[model samples]
Target: MSQGLPYDKITSAYAGTIVYPPKGTYGPRMQQDLQLVLLHTGELELTIDGSRHAVKPGQAVLLKPQHQEYFAFAETQESWHRWITLDLASLTDEEQDYLDKLPFSMPIPEALNTMTDMMLALQNDYLRQDELMRSLGYSAFQMFTARISLTKQQELHPSVVAALGYIRQHYMEDIALHDLAGAAGVSPEHLVRLFHVHHQMTPIRYLWQYRVLKATELLSQSGLSVGEIAARCGFKTAFHLSRLVKEQTGSTPSDIRKAAWGTAN
Candidate 1:
């Protein structure tokens, strides 16, 4: 089977969120488009062509086109979920087959929530989502699939997961090794060992890299000045931001920004 599709090539056609009432049911019928469902709360049992798959809270399921699909939501409470429809006509046979062979149930990637929030900040409503935001969301889908593939290769340590979640949420703030450990509910030494084992670096190194990554995004996507971007991304100053941005991307902040706007000097 194919490993996966090129992330940049997987564009999103439409995306939206839904909340189904307890025991809600839909369709022992057909789905015409390729869609991915991310369940945030409660449960979902998807019956596709006589195969039943249970999708729990924090899980995702990829619904392929031309399937006799059925959806059964939680019986006790409302179920919250999001769906992103892929641009199906653009996929090659290998890519389509790779998606088809994917498991029916997988955990909803944390990066999806982060990406949706980031892109949503650019476009206030899904109904009014602009092409640029949709493009960014498409990249997010690729990230989801890439991360899922990596996860399938190796299960992440729970402490690493917890620490990473905290970092993603608070990368703009002042963070220390103890703070990371506290978030992961581990001691400083244990957290460091875990990071070294999984990430091949210390937690602080990861935090700094994450800050630079976010700074790069803001530099490309927002009109914020270098200093402002630095402040928002937890860099000590514009110099720090530029230094790391150059180190990580081999391009200075202004150059990256100009390139993103198609006017690089």
Candidate 2:
């Protein structure tokens, strides 16, 4: 069966390596987004929806939305792992369906080396945030997903996809949830739930994050002043943009620009 996950957009992605503290435990709760965790050293014990899964080195776990999970380092040993968090709403229906079929945990002994390398690449590209690096990161994510999934194609809801396009096209405007819902031909309440399920955030939060991301790009690539960049990125003012940027990234606009230009501000 040439069942494969469809190629879907990656809205946002980041990867990190973590070492669990001795006797560390995480969450006896549910997650709102999709997560991929790859064990590199020691062992992790996961309880998913009441089922116990022992994740060994060279193994990975794919957790879907709303899945109740609890995790801890086994035998109080320090465990090293790499994890990626993705917005699943960007998936097409086919891709989401394929993802739904995969086992919660699987051994990828042969792919250990390749997977680790890809994770590192993704982390670097995300941090750099250049146009080329962003593109490469998206491609790397697709390849990583393909290697782990057994499906051939992924698809998103047509309306949701349409809404995404609309947001991308008009992100610089003062857009509202109702506007997006109208574009998708759904009620505002429905749109909120849809975003929550797929994007793991409300539509407004997504809009804010998108604006911030765009502003950062401008800060890095353009000679525009903070006010000019803020206007172009749809902030109410430079102050508004600066506040959000600092809140989200812990960096001021000047600092971001200075870093990009290799100058001290």
Candidate 3:
């Protein structure tokens, strides 16, 4: 039997590379694939599993599998990175544990600089049609995960978890900080502090991001009009939806539809 090409053997569930331009948002996007994002320049804000992180220069973000990762650049800075789509079967027990503990936004370590260089080089090779580049890329992911696996464990506070849960449930509706504080059984001031300490996002920004994420899914999976989608996602109007979508995804609903279906009727 002949061996399959590496790219060919890349299962639909497998990982691949994605490049983001200046002022780009990779998503209000979620994937089942394991992804390691290395920020080349610019700042990246990642909201994963209802927490927000701002990762700046010389830092990296790991997107955990099945977690919702929504990203937007802090400015018009060009942020570029490579992603490897990986299936659950490929991860070892240790790596799985590491991923479970993460969706981290932290500065890249000096020790991992060598690995980052190698991952970038492999991206170039893969672009140039080198089949061995896939192997190199996988190795780089491994090294990056191994580095994180060694970090000390941090305990999560009860209020933080409650706030995250409330966001996930009520993202499609209008909710206020006091509402979340009530759900978490804390005062509004205390809830705000918990959000800052654990998630780095205020409650309102998290709700906005969550709504945008839901709006993106509706845009992709349903045939709803922009106005309808805006209402469904708790936006005041289609124009508001259009503006926010453009600001976050660099495209309007009509634009996304046109790209997906070739034309918007």
Query: Residues 1-265, candidate 3, lDDT per residue (tens digit)?
Result: 0010122322322223345666787667776765666676677787877788888777766666667878887566566654444343455565556457653655576534543444444443234233233333343444454344334223557776677678778776778889989998999999888867654567677677567657866875689898899998889889988887665444467655553443432
Q: What is the lDDT of candidate 3?
A: 0.59
Which is the leading candidate under TM-score? 1
- Give me candidate 2's TM-score against the actual structure: 0.46
How would you encode candidate 1's per-residue C-alpha lDDT over 139-182 as one tens digit per residue? 45555554664575347788888898899899999998999999
Residue 82 lDDT, candidate 1, scale 0-100? 82
TM-score of each: 0.54, 0.46, 0.44
Which candidate should be chosen as best, given lDDT against the real structure? Answer: 1
lDDT of 2 by residue, 1-265 (tens): 0123322343445566878877888899887666677888878889988888888888777777667899988676788888766554455567667667766666653433343454455454345343222333343343345344323213555566667778778989989888999999999898888776655567788778678868977987799999998888889999999998776554578866664564632
Against the correct fold, how does model 1 do in TM-score? 0.54
- In what order do the candidates fall by TM-score, top score first? 1, 2, 3
What's each prediction's clash count? 0, 19, 3
Alpha-carbon runs more than 4 Å astray in model 1: 1-12, 119-130, 154-265
lDDT (Cα atoms) of all candidates against the true structure: 0.72, 0.66, 0.59
What is residue 22's positional error in candidate 3, in angstroms? 37
